[model samples]
Target: MSTVPLIRGYEVVIGLETHAQLSTRSKIFSGASTQFGAEPNTQACPVDLALPGTLPVMNRGAVERAIRFGLAVGAKVAPQSIFARKNYFYPDLPKGYQISQYEIPVVQGGKVGFFVGDHRKTVNLTRAHLEEDAGKSLHEDYHGQTGIDLNRAGTPLLEIVSEPEMRSSAEAVEYAKALHALVVWLGICDGNMQEGSFRCDANVSVRRPGQPYGTRREIKNLNSFRFLQQAIDYEVQWQIEQIEDGLPIVQATVLFNPDTGETRSMRTKEDAHDYRYFPDPDLPPLVIDPAWVEQVKAAMPELPSTMAERFQQEDGLPAYDATMMTQSLAMARFYEAARDASGQPKLVANWLMGEVSRRLNTEGGSIEASPVAAGTLAALIGRIVDGTVSNNGARQVFDALWGGDTDVDAVIEAKGLKQMNDEGALAAIVDQVLAANAKSVDEYRAGKDKAFNALVGQVMKASKGKANPAQAGELLKKKLG
Candidate 1:
């Protein structure tokens, strides 16, 4: 649970419904290709088009992916689940209805844990069901006419519904990001927001403290996390303004306009009865054996939560650092490779979280696309550990490495960035600094700590920023005594 932050004296409540496009190659019922960017109507087979004398056949890959997702979240995987036809009339839906799970979904009762800042929070899930997606109605490029693209029709989807537990927009974003990472790590979804492989719809409402739940409006089809946060913020403010002005908040489906940063009503929100859900006569009930679940569990990769715990116990990383290291499988692999190569877990963690992360963010790249390799970074960390270079010098070495230099030692020598470790040379420099700053030394003898720091800075300046700061302080203190 998260601490609910009040917005203008009202508590903002939010939940999310996410549709993850499964990674199966074929449609959920038909043999049509489920690939994106295909020519319109070219990939829709007779079954997808709802032609006479055609029957729907189930895709086993989609069901297996659903099972994998249920197991990953520690949800209950029902042995038997029924498919229902949700009656809805839309031009893009050739069948005039969607096949989905209603009463008995395949996955139920799970939780997703994430971090908002340094606090850990958990959001419980309501259900995750399998469904088929609708086709797209393209309104552009048809010269005042709409074109229907059936390539996405009948594609496999897992609609994960969450409880209304999020207290703020930041919590909602973190929860969505965690769910996205899990699906991609489980190999069930591609997790590409730009390609429409993953989408989110947020249900937002606001209520006074200790009052009943407020009327929620669904903000639909948020493809980016930035839009998700912005939409919720505007929606919350709008609802509060309406209540303050003696206007009732209406229950409707809304669209987020990124340009204006507001939400407009699309249609009145419908309940389950409005769709007239009933068991589908064409498809039989889905059955999953206990043995199948066991097999899938055995072949599954290590989960991110488990891996984070392992990093904490074995490598002595803090909880935040461990969580960051295991954000994605590629990132975890990168951290482990660097930690193992350098034999310095803490140092490696610091660099990855600080310098490496800053560089990656500035370049708008992912860990997988990092220009610096793990081995090269590990070697740079080794230089700092063995007293070969100071922290500032290491940054210069990293800059060279990122710019295409391969040899670490060569870069260090070329820039003259090596630390001044010679005992006699450093002692002589400290003595000279003491003589030059006699007034500062007298101030230090009078119990002024700032004067001591100034004297050390003068020593570093005399040695041209190559002296070990700790050693300089020690030599300065001894000479003054």
Candidate 2:
């Protein structure tokens, strides 16, 4: 049995505050382009840089996309909400404050249900709200200097806060991945981890089950799921050691170092009063009418968990296969295409999980960029099903077809990869092999092991490996008998 470490008769409690940048065409307030990788400060807008004399304006697309997410999670969309100014001074935050929703977020109280190892857990979301992202500070390779990039400033972001209900790192990762899939499916966020479009901030603490909670450490800006798990594991162990040494945990903001597998303090954790949050008098409160909310809700796409269940029930797939296929929207679509074209859902799953995924991983390709078209791939499988080629022959055909450069059937015919199914054709080669290896043939007649396989290999070599294995075995057995 596996035991929960640091159980001290206590459990580790965690909450995740994940931020996903909405994939909108424009900044939340300005018409400046939201495209990434621009020259530093080039993408900065008058409103984004918090230049004086600029009035705050809302982005309708961002608001609508946020509503789509709230409805997808069955959350409550508040009819009215205020955009408060979170006061903090940093070079990146040129305005000296971040315009964010605090007390009255746009949505509240929903649950995200997903499966992990056959068990389903519902992670309760406290709220999801829209805010403007801050600029980035480049600290590395600056030679004792720091560079500020305002490219991300004022870009729209949806901050989803989950309740402290996760028990393990795997559970936290599952919850984070589920939320990531949710935003991507809704077309609200790009869900790009390497680009920092989607990020997780984990709040970790340990407590005796029957006792009150302990001071929690907030680890900010964990960019990958693997890093998230590592950060949580190291933090939990650190907290347990501190408690055992009679050292109380400090409430502080920390950063996780994936290279070192450690969490270090960044700053003391700040309370609401620390930022001196106040309603921004510059911007009016957002009033979302019912009709508009309904429109956004109606436009919402199917959530991932729901789609996964459908793939299992409707596609007649195993739970694991369905779950793996539905991990991303694009992958799920690819599976559906192959399934529809070939009418072989199980084969589609196997190919996707096996060679297809392997090649994709090796070449750093996505489902959208795969060289093999779905229809073409399904056709190749059909050839194998009809016995036009053997399994090994199918692989050669696949390689030729995978580049989208060659016709599969033409490749097979050009290479003469068709199976040698004629009994007479295989019989001639078998007799030649048996004649060449009389001692082995005599041993086989006397019931010696491995003689038959040796003879079979000879026939295969004589036919240049195009001989059908089953038919060759049958002819060889008849001749030997």
Candidate 3:
């Protein structure tokens, strides 16, 4: 069993609901473009506006994307799924209801696997349903009147609902990231939190260990992973406090304010019955053919987990390194190019996960935006392996290559960072150091290891760090003997 997070002796349980905007050029039910940042109501068509004479036509591209997602996650794509009218009223909703899959969703019963610490966790998914997004409510620019942007109103979304299996905020964020990576990798969503292409709502509840599940309050629209963690942590503590103070934790929807780092109640939560979901009279049932599913499966890219396992088996990398190398398709591709070019898979992995990843993170960029190319990094590692440069000298070459189009050999030559591999020259330097440091040599003959190290340091200093440390150590040992 998975361990639950205990805060002040109470267990925190969490589930997530994520909405991933499909990458179709057109909206789900209309020919309206799903483009972002358009003028309000300009993108809405007759079907999106819910005119009396209009009807919705399902976009084949959107359905194909959903099928692609189901294949990627190993979920069951129902042959027949129904769309229902989710009855609700909001200022931004044009039709006074949302067209969504409620009772019979398109994709059902899959598990997303992620690593939390060292333990591999699989969060069970309930369903991923196709839904039409509502329009946005714009308030800041409108002088006491709200503006509705219908550009997002008819956007296609796959609402992925997870079971209440998460035990803490950390696990929840991991689940979110894994889901985000999966959808983006499948080319279904862009995974842009800033633009709301992918967003999560966390349902949090606290109770005694082994007790019945407590009432859950949903924290809505956490667009950032950092905000997701903060919101859940605060909500868990707030619920525990409420129980202790003899206050009932009411079931309601709340919004997280990132600046204040707190969540405030928005409105009372509604159950499934409150939505008044029913089969849409206007739209027919969504039927996916088995042959169509097979076609999508044939074209699906290799999943991340499958690629990670292959890395372990072929590259001899540890589990963690294999998983991290497959964090994104770009990163994995980079690793492959470097490894093939250098003929040193392990060395390439080291450089990528070490210096390359560090610089990318510091610059707030990704592997796709890296300044160092795979061939250039491969050349640098080759120099190190051929004894042309020490690990220290290779770093110098790497620094010069980063953010520049300079050649590896040019940097090595310009900086004069080549290792002194000449056995004759290094032997002469070792003899001079030995003659100059007679006391150290005597101390070394007297079985003092530090004295021997001092003599080796003298050799490195004499040659100005050009002499390879391994060669120096060997020459010094021969002279002392």
Candidate 4:
């Protein structure tokens, strides 16, 4: 639980339902291809179209992915689960019903722990069940008519439901990001929001503190994190305004318009009974043997939390640094490679978090696409540690390295960025600086700390920015005494 701040004399409660498309080559119940960007209707087969005399068969890969997720989150993998038919009608749902889990879900009772700007928060998960996806409705190119694309029909999905634990939009975004990373890290989903591989629906409501929970409106299909935050913020304000104006908040399903940044009602909300869920006679009960679960546990990769703890104990990294390093598998591998090569954990962590991260964010690039390789970054850090370059000089070298330079030593030498390590030469430069800045030296002897910094700056300037600042400060202190 998080210590949520009150918004306008009311407490905002939020929960999220996320749909993650499983990374299977074929559909969940059919053999149709699941690749994206194909001719829309061409991918639909007889089973996907729900033609007469067709039956549904389970995809083993999809079940394995659900098991992997359950183990990762410490959730219970139910030995027996059943599927039900959720009755609904829409243009894209040719079957007039959806295959989903209602009573006994595949995964039950887990919690996702994440950080909201250094304050740790955990959101409890109610359930994560396997389901099939509905197709898309195309209206743009239909010339005032609507088109149905059944390509996405029968695609496997894991719908994860959370408790009403999140209290702020910022906290919700962090939780979403953490969930996205975990899915991608587990290789269960691609986690591509733009391609509709992952989507979120936020259930938002507001109430006076110490009162019963307010009626929640479900904001649907928020594909991006920015949109997720914006939709919740708008919805919370709208609910608060409605209550303050003496109007009751209606429970409904809403869609968020990204262009206008507002939510409009789609339909009145329906409870579980409205869907008329019942056991699907076509599909049998899904039963998992204990042996299969044990096999999966043996094959499971080290999870992020476990990896972060290992980084803290083995590499002597702080908890925050370790968590950041394990944000993705690629990032963790990069950090380890650089740390091992440089033999300096803290220095590598600082450079990665500060300079490397800034460059990646500016270019909208991932760690895998970074121009500087791990060995190259390690070489640069090595130079800084060996007194071959100052921190300022190292930045210059990094800039060149990022611009396609292959050799670190060559760049440092070619740009004359090496620090002045000659003891006699540095002593002479410090002596000249002390002689010139007589007033600053006198002020430093009289206990003015700023004066000492000014004198060090003068020495660095006299040495043409090649002086090691720490060494110059030591020499200045010795000469002044």
Which candidate number would show the highest lDDT if scored against the true structure? 4
lDDT order of candidates, top first: 4, 1, 3, 2
List clash counts for every candidate, in order: 0, 1, 0, 0
TM-score for predicted model 1 compared with the true structure: 0.97
| Over 4 Å off, model 1 | none
User: TM-score for every candidate vs. truth?
Assistant: 0.97, 0.82, 0.92, 0.97
lDDT of each: 0.93, 0.87, 0.92, 0.93
Where does the lowest 10-residue lDDT sum fall in candidate 4?
1-10
TM-score result, candidate 3: 0.92
Better of 1 and 2 by TM-score: 1
Clashing pairs in 2: 7-10
Q: After aligning candidate 1 to the native by TM-score, how far in Å is the CA of 142 from where it should be? A: 2.3
lDDT of 1 by residue, 1-481 (tens): 5356899999998999999999999999987888888888888888877788988898999999999999988999999999999999998998999989999999987899999999999999999999999989999989999998888889999999999999999999999999999999999999999989999999999999889999999999999999999999999999999999999998999999999999999999999999999998999999999999999999999999999999999999999899989888999999999999999998988999998899998998889988789999999999998888889999999999889998899999999999999989999999888888889989999999999999989988998989988888888888899
Please, what are the lDDT tens digits per residue for candidate 4 over residues 31-137?
99999999988888888877899999999999999999999998999999999999999999989999999999999979898888777788999999999999999
What candidate 4 gets wrong by more than 4 Å, as runs, is none
Q: Give the alpha carbon lDDT tens digit for every residue of 1-481 in model 3.
A: 7356588999888999999999999999999999888877899998997899999999998899999988877789999999999999998998999999999999998889888876789999999999999999988968999888888888999999999999999999999988998898888999999999999999999999999999999999999999999999999989999999999999999999999999999999999999999999999999999999999999989999999999999989888788778878888999999999999888999888899999998998989988899999999999999989989899888998895956999898889999999999999999899889999999999999999889878998999889998889998887777
Better of 2 and 4 by TM-score: 4
Q: Per-residue error at 387 for model 2, in Å? A: 3.6
Judge candidate 1 at residue 26 and give its lDDT.
96
Collision pairs in model 4 = none
Say which prediction, candidate 1 or candidate 4, comes out ahead on lDDT: 4
